[model samples]
Target: MGESVKYYVLLILRGMAMGAADVVPGVSGGTIAFITGIYEELLDSIRKIGPNTLKALLNEGIPGAWRQCNGAFLASIFGGIAISMVSFARMITWALENHPILVWSFFFGLVAASVVYIFRQLTSVSWREIMALAIGLGLAVFVSVARPVALPDYWWVVMLSGSVAICAMILPGISGSFILLLIGIYPVFIGAIESFNLPLIASFLLGCGVGLLAFSHVLSWLLKHYHNVTLALLTGFLMGSLNVIWPWKQILETTVDRHGEVIPLVQQNILPLTYESLIGLPSQLWPAIGVMFLGLFLVLGLEAISNNMSRCE
Candidate 1:
């Protein structure tokens, strides 16, 4: 009983980590799952809901297959994700609103440490891996710098964005929110959530539901046949995304909408760090850096516990 409760808590924590990553532009919930050793299991469990399970449900009824294949586990994990996303959305949104720079700084540190952790996990560093890493890095950088498109505020576009973004959501190197931002749907999608607009939200979710089923097949195949290569690529993807999430920057340009809200469309400059900035940092930056270190230590502690648990197993 105690062990079961402990695992449940761990899963909830994992879901929260996933939620945080999904909220960011360059990070991914899938990356969080991969680093935590739950990626393959998650893919497999989701894949079970295909034809075989459907047939079983129709023929033997829901209860039989549900019990035989452990539906409760899937329900528990996904339910946790759903709960975390909905519950944390407001709090995260508020944090981003009130403390954008500090929040980004903490995540910046998280990803920086994550890149190191992932690099250390690689068993071999061949020329192929090197090339792959460079390619991944370049691709991520390109995406980060590309100008956002002005997409139409149509329901169809919203659905398309949701489908594509959700597909990207599970890939560690790809940012789902960034995908939306690139497609010019980021503002509307975020607006829907912010305003509690039900129609737009429903359309987006329907598309995401469809995309998840389609994407899971590809993910499952990669896991089964090309696990190492996939992980390597994902690691490269995460490493490349560092450029997008880098914290220090200023809004060099700004515009206002009809509603009189200032929209900063382009960031004209990134404030590169100097020795003086670190040594004589302002109070806000210093506390943010400390929080960044705390985030790093949290991941390291989780890694240590995971290693110990693996040894016991």
Candidate 2:
């Protein structure tokens, strides 16, 4: 294949990885983008989709606007993300249901490795950076542990949830679906996807469009002006998020869903032995540990390959 085709194909695979991560409650697609070495480019492309691109389309025409906004790259990435979400949603949900420990363990390793990767991005650490890290860590921990708030299942509510969730989805440490869960709209959003409810999905997508455009600008500005502090904070966010993905947890509370099904609401982390004793189920400890290492090594391997590719370039 030509170099251009090869590059686009890699972008699509990265997008698929991002989509897969976004589906999980504690994984961030932005984290995938960051680790894959495309986070800044992704943000810049999204930020380009505003007034300048519109003017180019109106005045300079389609081809001009496409070049201005990096249309081909955006299209390839989004196409992959859409395909992965639509195709893999059911499969991921099934895995979560049947093999929760393994699924969580794998992502747990991803996030833990990601924290180290992000931390190493910093050139120097100082007291101010340490404070920023602490703040980010504390905020993520608070949000992760907070109780879910019940929201009315209205059209507007769904839109609002999408807006909020999309913003979280793009942040390195935050999970958009987890945000939806905290707002009590996760099941509603997932149902729309699984059932192919066009109207509902359209509303959510509209919200996502608005949120992505607005948040991208802010993130781009922050990265430009305060790169180190922001990286530190993001690293802390990833560190704090590890609590959510930890494999061994005991449900502390349950709530009835819209379908009148009981589901876990609040959970507390526990030792593997404690999980076995209290939950009275196989903790699956050894398998989970093995999967965690697999995830860690996967990230490390990807990073090494990326470095080699950069050197070749």
**Highest lDDT model number:** 2
TM-score of 2: 0.98
Candidate 1 residue pairs that clash: none
User: What clash count goes with each model?
Assistant: 0, 0
Residues 1-313, model 1: lDDT tens digits: 8877787777777877786678666677887776676777777777777778877888899896786455776666666666766676678778877776687777777777777777787778887678777777777777777876657767877887888998778887788988887776776776777688889988888888788878988988985786656666777787777777766555555655444767556653355454236435443667678878976886677678778766865
User: Candidate 1 at 271: error in angstroms?
Assistant: 3.2
The lDDT of model 1 is 0.73
Model 2 over residues 3-100: C-alpha lDDT tens digits? 87888898899899888888889999989989988889899999999889989999989998998889998998888888888888999999999999
TM-score of each: 0.87, 0.98
- Stretches of model 2 off by over 4 angstroms after superposition: none
Candidate closest to the true structure, highest TM-score: 2
